[model samples]
Target: MPVIVLEAKDFTSPLFLMRTCAVLSSCTAFSLVASQQSVLEPESNTFRVFCMFTWCFFFILTLLIHILSIIQFHSLIPISWKNLVITVAVLGGLMSFSASVLFPWNVMDRQKVTPRCVAAAVASCLTVLAYASESCVLCIQPHEQRGYMGSTPGLLKILQLWGGCQMIPLIVDVAHGLHGVHAWQLWASGASYSVCVLLSFVTLVVILGDLAGRCLLPFDRFLAGFSLIGVLLYMLATVICFTKILQLRNPGQSSPKIGELFIMETVVSSVTLLAYTVDLAFSIKQLCDRSHM
Candidate 1:
């Protein structure tokens, strides 16, 4: 006997789907509200108030990181490479920090182009070169006995990658400032910036992974983690800024309203500020740890 089986409905009932969607929507709304309250309930003078403060914090953090790195190199590395790396890191950090201070001001004024863009480009270039040089030095070190140039080699390589990636945005910003470009040109520049920012973030993750996998001195491991957090935060902010610029240029088939863009930028900038603060904490912690040790 051939038994005919009734086929189940090929599709879900519209009513059921609608009910599920409603539930999901409610949950999402609740989650968003909770997140906002948690993130935004701070005092008026909170760190989120000014982007400049965040930038300054990260700048100082980067300086401290470089200083600690210098100290470590002096104590552990041979003298030949020690002075060179320390000099480059210190000078590069100073120049980079100074350029960061100038960036937002340039963004605000919009009419005047500042030499800060050029300085930033130069500083980023120097950082990349310096880190690459450090990596080479690490690779050649007699103490580097483990696989693939050891922990120090891996760390330096990651740093070199991060530094090199950041140089693109710096150069593009300099070019845009020098040429007095239009919004479209600025958006084009953002493409390179986006790529650089993404690469920096990936490098940061790789550094974290490297730290997690390898056994190293407590201070060294902490430094790696600390640097990773700082770089990651910077990259996140950069990605948001670049993405907003891209959206402004090409809003797609459904152009986002001006209100939407403003909200996005506000949200992105706020998150960026918070990340920068956390990065500062990490740097300060590193400095303290090094001092104690």
Candidate 2:
């Protein structure tokens, strides 16, 4: 049997950090939406409109989550922590769903198949959902033991839920990229993207196993570091590949489509990735230290 343990003092900083990230995600979505409005051709092509609608929906949901997070901070909400977690999970699910649909829409057009944009869009969705799950489950107090690694069922369940959801799209995205990449680009950008996906998948698997559950304290710490390092590598690889693809598509940087892709990749995507990097560092350190006590 497992028991859930949480501390109010330990939850605040991560909550605030996640809130800031959500705010940035929402803001960048809005800015991209606004920028695309001028060039959107509702009659000939609906790509811009479709993209804007999806981001608008995601922005509103994130805004709602942000409000809920703030209300929780003020203690104005009478809801329990479980309730708050469920609420965030639901909103985050919706946000991820919206992005998933938009990503495919970006490439559904037979004439324009930008695999790089598709991959970046899909990656952004995964990062957003991962951060959401991380923030929601941040209160699980890490315990240190001499013989076995310590973690709650709740933590593993949350990870499994979000990680499984993100995994499917990553596969589809990689396959999509494979069909279109040049030989040199395939060896370069394509290889990196595939490795990124593999690393993310491996990290998720490593953290959810029985060995992870029963490992020594030092082993648990090592796993946490290992998982985050994989994530950082994935981020770097994805960003580099995405940027290169963007440059190759529009060498002069004059296309509106390129502009939209750039903003989404650099601004909106970076917001979630940077915030998650900070949250994960703080979280792993907190877990190890808490267990030591």
Candidate 3:
């Protein structure tokens, strides 16, 4: 008798779906924090607003892909086409994040360029080209060819890579926060900065774990729970941070304006984190049920 071996799970499975959600949730949370920073600084600026809009748009589209994937919606583009779209979306997000970093928060002229901007542009373009080649190669290859990353590299690998790219800007922002942590009069601001650092470490660990071929069943249980706790802590810290920012804003500013800003940030962070937490918990529960059987 011959023994048969099963390939690792692919995009169609619950694990992949949950992993995708986890990546997007992390990105969304970071974007919300960035947007809040932009809002709290000086006057409301168009360039900053555009950057936030771009990132938010990317998050929504990726999330819709997750939903359509779960429902097996046939009306959507073919799987390969969907992959290409996602690749483009992720690249766009990368550009948006880079812009947020390279450009000042309040650039009035769109044509303005500096030495730093030039460097940022060059780096962003190179990144896009590299990822584009990878995405095209991944999409053009048949399932068998995609197997190089491992049988189960699946959509999780792609999503995790994208998530890691999106973190570059957030990481920069965190550096700034850390530098100014001592100057912050509000305790919440300092605490939020600490949480951001912790979250950054968590994201780095996740990226390393996936690349190290540790994204598996029992380990995933731990990753999922760890991620949920990190996100929850970040959200708690963010609410406090935003509330402090609002109170510290210009006294002449309308109360409604400040309240609205706080409300918006809270809602975006809460919704994204809640969705991710639910998905991770669900995936863990399923794993438990199967193990008992």
Candidate topping TM-score: 3
TM-score of each: 0.26, 0.38, 0.40
Model 2, span 74-142: residue lDDT tens: 244343333334434444544455555554555444345444444445554653765465444544433
Q: Candidate 3, TM-score vs. the true structure?
A: 0.40
Candidate 3, 1-293: lDDT as tens digits: 33333235556454344435433543543444463333234343433544555545555655665555455562444334333344444444444444444344333233454444444334433433433443444445576444322223223333334333333334344334342222343344345435544543553445423433555545556556655654565466456546545554556433543344445334434543454455456557767887799
**Model 1 weakest lDDT span, ten residues long:** 40-49
- The alpha-carbon lDDT assigned to residue 46 of candidate 2 equals 44
**lDDT ranking from best candidate downward:** 2, 3, 1
Candidate 1 stretches with Cα past 4 Å from truth are 1-140, 143-179, 211-293
lDDT of 1 by residue, 1-293 (tens): 44333234512533223223322332332233223322322221121223223233333434444444434433443322332333333333333333333333333234433344334334433433443343344345555332332333333433433343333433343343332224553454355435435643554444433443454545345544544654564466455455545545544312333333334343433444444445445556666787899
When summed lDDT is taken over every stretch of 10 residues in candidate 2, the lowest stretch is 142-151
**lDDT for residue 19 in candidate 1, whole number 0-100:** 25
* Pairs that clash in candidate 2: 144-291, 149-215
Extract clashing residue pairs from model 1. none
Score residue 10 of candidate 2 by CA lDDT: 38
